[model samples]
Target: MRFLPSVQFIEQSRVADEFVAPAAVLANRLLDAKGLGGLPPCSVSYFIEELHRPGAAIGLHSKGRANVRLNLAWLAKLAQQETAPEWEVAFVILHEYAHFVLELLEAREVSPGATRRRIEAGHADFLRRMSHLGWLADPVSRKLLSNHNAIAEEWYCDAFAYWVAGTLPEPHAEFFYELLAGVRFPPTS
Candidate 1:
């Protein structure tokens, strides 16, 4: 995968470090170990500044391809603190990569009209299932039912992170684990 140009900001008192390298390696290791090899090549770029988006999202992935942009400000904070868990950075990278993989899967679909609707409905169905599994109050899952494409993409990414890390403290994490229980290894085309 080709990495695009990235911008970094570090206080003059602190030394800049290669955080991206280790994060990428960890993300790749999880993807390979999980047998999710169908995803196309992708790149991740890091920045110490806030993204131009309106909310406080820590990362962003391109919708149609395997590319990610991470918030280095958050990463650097985690790097400097001893209390920060090792899986934090890796989870962020893996989640973004999952978004790429899902989008690649969607784009590769060659079926006609109803197929697209069916795929979206499948994702929505999963979200609805989560509600029944005790995730009814989760904001993300609630959005999932109405915001098909983007919310489903986020759900898939979060599920990938949960799968890699083995646990998530979030209220809706159980929903992801339940989904994982039924998925076939290496994933079908």
Candidate 2:
């Protein structure tokens, strides 16, 4: 995707100012690869570490911008596994991006009833649209849906992450499969 000049790239370390910390360059690269590299001014705010947790997590608000908390220990663990922790980081960004898309498309109608209606009414169309965009090729497994809220917006974000990863710089079938393997839904045609 082409990046416009309106985007601003904020380094995590700069936010902390007076401390030596783990670098978030990989995380930055992942967001860039996913086409959300630069945020528009207050559109996004990133913090290097968290006051409580020690892993990559995000605290979101009703509005667009969010505080992304990246934990060093969690990233180191993810790095030692295989692909960079960026995939998960990318997912974090897309999770918020999904919120943005939903708000834009739905005109701020994000209530539970409205969301479920949208998901159900647009179910086929949603999958088809995502599939046409090459998002549905990844099958959601039964293990995950078993424990997750089937009608939740979080599911949409998870599905979007899989789709973005496929089309972005890292096409990770294995990691995605692992993510989907936890799906609790039964397979369907």
The models' CA-based lDDT, in order, is 0.52, 0.42
- Candidate 2 — what's its lDDT? 0.42
1-189, model 2: which lDDT tens digit per residue?
111121121233332321112223433444445444443211234443446454545645455554444444344334445443444555555555555444544543545456446545433344344446464343442211333425546655555554545542222334333323322133222
| lDDT (10s digit) by residue, model 1, range 81-116 | 555334666676777776555545455556544333
TM-score of candidate 1 relative to the true fold: 0.57
Best by TM-score: 1
Worst 10 residues of 2 by lDDT: 1-10
User: Model 2 segments beyond 4 Å from truth?
Assistant: 1-56, 62-67, 80-83, 108-116, 120-146, 149-151, 166-189
> How much does candidate 2 score in TM-score?
0.43
Worst 10 residues of 1 by lDDT: 1-10
